[model samples]
Target: MTFQAGGSFDIDAWDADKPYDERDGTKLTRVSVRKTFHGDLVGTSTTELITVESSAGPVAYVGIEHVQGILHGREGTFVLQHSAGSEDGTPGTQWLRWLIVPTSGTGELAGIRGVGQITVTEDGAHTWTLEYSLD
Candidate 1:
């Protein structure tokens, strides 16, 4: 059966490298981030991302996040594949998505699979929604 989870998370840390590649007006960099979740899903996660930026602002990013803790009451771990982008570097034009890595669930989370999305509020708060199922 499918379950829905929703929550907000706080960014605990963010470490980014100087642009490793720059050309014209675009640049690429690597970033590592840590977050703590609250609400229906309670956990901590570490993410590694590759980002693209332009004069307008952030253009896109792809990442992998490993999360550990509890979802509802099920305790375990899972990995999320992220793909986010903006056509105009504006919130109205951006999309932040996550795909639960197949077979990456451990412990009580085994066989979990689904997709999720993240929303960044204008004031910079981050919230998420997930739809998933476990075998």
Candidate 2:
């Protein structure tokens, strides 16, 4: 059966650094993220976000997040892969999407498969909805 987990998260820490200049005023930046989640899913996640930036704006980014926590009382861990892009920073133009890595689930969540979506409001309120099923 499929289940839904809804929750909010707070960015506990974000460490970013520019390691090199690719060219044309574009730089390669690496960021480490630590977040704490609340509500239906409870625990913390550590993620690495790599962003490609130019003089205009951020061209693209890819992130891999390891989520460790309890979902609806099941204790386990999983991974989420994030990919997104946007240069103009226009509303409805920039997109961020995350998906579960196949067979990455462990513990009680072994064999879990699903997709998740995240939304961040202007006030920095982050929310997530995960639709998933467990084997």
Q: Give the top-scoring candidate (TM-score).
A: 1
Off by over 4 Å in 1: none
- Give the CA lDDT, 0 to 100, for residue 68 in model 2: 99
**Best lDDT goes to which candidate?**
1
Model 1, residue 49: distance off in Å is 0.2
Model 2 C-alpha lDDT versus the unseen true structure: 0.87
lDDT of 2 by residue, 10-109 (tens): 9999999865558777778899999999988999999999988877677678999999999999999999999877756543466777899999999998
Tell me the tens digit of each residue's lDDT in model 1 across 1-135: 999999899999999999999999999999999999998889999999999999989999999999999998999999999999999899999899999999999998989999999999999899999999999
lDDT of 2 at 112: 88
- Candidate 1's TM-score reads 0.98
Q: Rate the local accuracy (lDDT) of all candidates.
A: 0.96, 0.87
Instruction: Write down the TM-score of every candidate.
Output: 0.98, 0.89
lDDT of 2 at 117: 78
